[model samples]
Target: MDVAVEVEDLWFTYPGSTEPTLRGINLRIERGSFTIIAGPSGCGKTTLCRCFNGLIPHFYGGTLRGRVLVNGIDVASRSTHELAREVGMVFQEPEDQLICLSVEREIAFGPENLGLPTEEVKSRVEEALKALRIEHLRDKAPFELSGGEQQKVAIAAALALKPSVLVLDEPTSNLDPVSALELTKALIELNEEGLTVILVEHRLDLVARYADQVVLMDRGAVLVQGDPREALSSEEALRLGVAVPKPIRLFKQLLVHGVKLARPPLTSEELAEGLVEFLGRHRG
Candidate 1:
């Protein structure tokens, strides 16, 4: 029930850019919750994520205003390296994150840089390998792995940091459909295991079912923010071009024609079950 991240009136402009990429953004994400931020391309989704882990003002060299806090610590007051300990970030492209040659080395990179003992670093690496189910690929070269495997490695590296919050910006962008689904399932599993997850994604139909909270942003401002059931199905979200999961879309379409569903469904399985029950009742 505690807040993992809080943003207040956050405004920022990149170095040499005349306009601000983000404006008046306010959001509160609960700890251990899986939250998704969905918006059109160039909606400042990535810019906002950079702010989450203190990369905006610290590393990106931007003119930042307002405040962004992660785990009660102000982002602007901290160094990127300090923030990396509290907030782990995975970029859209896993290739960008493959700093080391082998998967084992990549996962150990963070802890090693943190000055942990050799045994502690190895233990962290082993823990991340187990957590991400990528131990078999430990000695393999990251570049030689499949896109999904590489993405999993990137996530494992972040997990090795044991951060309080994990912010992923379009983590599945380069993945196949199956790989994307796997990535989302992995995120849900992590959240269930007590890691706070903040995802910036575009494929809502696949990811929506896993998100407890959905946020819609446009023109560098939050348009809707709440439970996925309410926020993802809102007219404002749709009008703003945020894609609603098909189950909810179908449910809404059926209701418009006088057919009432048991309730709004966030997944296809729920919709199917509800429809079967409704048909059975009518046939009786």
Candidate 2:
């Protein structure tokens, strides 16, 4: 299978914590697919994403067991710098990652560090800027950009590495609705262009429609993993406080009233179509 990332029987614990934060995680992310890792707070979502890029045992100094492979290479055997060639990571807070004075410099940092020729670095910086639609913010200082803009800059910085996989952790937590939607559109555009996207987020409403799969976690273990319709529609997911999308919830209610949709809808548009079809057939 054309897998981008693979985790096997994974377990991990922090340096001082008495308990493991991730437990027996086994997952496979296919290349060029958009996947969402979601659950309630403290469900090990961040910890699991960390494993993909060697942050767990390497940077975090935690006890890690089992195996994590990115692009068929053992993450544990490779340094984080080496893993960066295949996986690009963006944290929850953009401020935590932004260190350059200007947005242009921030995006160029990764390629420049790789010791690429100056012209190559410049070319990558320009491409990254264009990809995220942040070309206008290039010359502006990182501090001057809004929260959404700063987040885009951070993503652009990661993209400059030309990684095959992009991992984002709660990237929309600090943005307003409009900004969040704008960011979501940009990400979808990138995913359509063949970059594998693995996102850790709670806002299912914004991303579920585009996700090829959803993995729901609970208390350091996977609660459900499958199609968005199947995963989000599970009673267990709602009970575990996974933010099942509004459309799924509405369809579930209709199901309770003896109305079954041929296919559960994940987005508002799909839900509307289902509703219209039901109304058309049952108009007494």
The collision pairs in model 2 are none
- Reference-based TM-score of each model: 0.95, 0.97
The most accurate candidate by lDDT is: 2
**How does model 2 fare in lDDT?**
0.92
Candidate 2 local lDDT, 147-201, one digit each (tens): 9999999889999999999999999999999999999899999999999999998
lDDT of 1 by residue, 169-261 (tens): 898889999999898888888999999999998888887877878999988999989888888778887788777888988998998887787
**Position 163, candidate 1: lDDT:** 97
What residue runs in model 1 are displaced by over 4 Å at the alpha carbon?
A: 276-284
- The positional error of residue 207 in candidate 1, measured at the CA in angstroms, is 2.1
Worst 10 residues of 1 by lDDT: 236-245
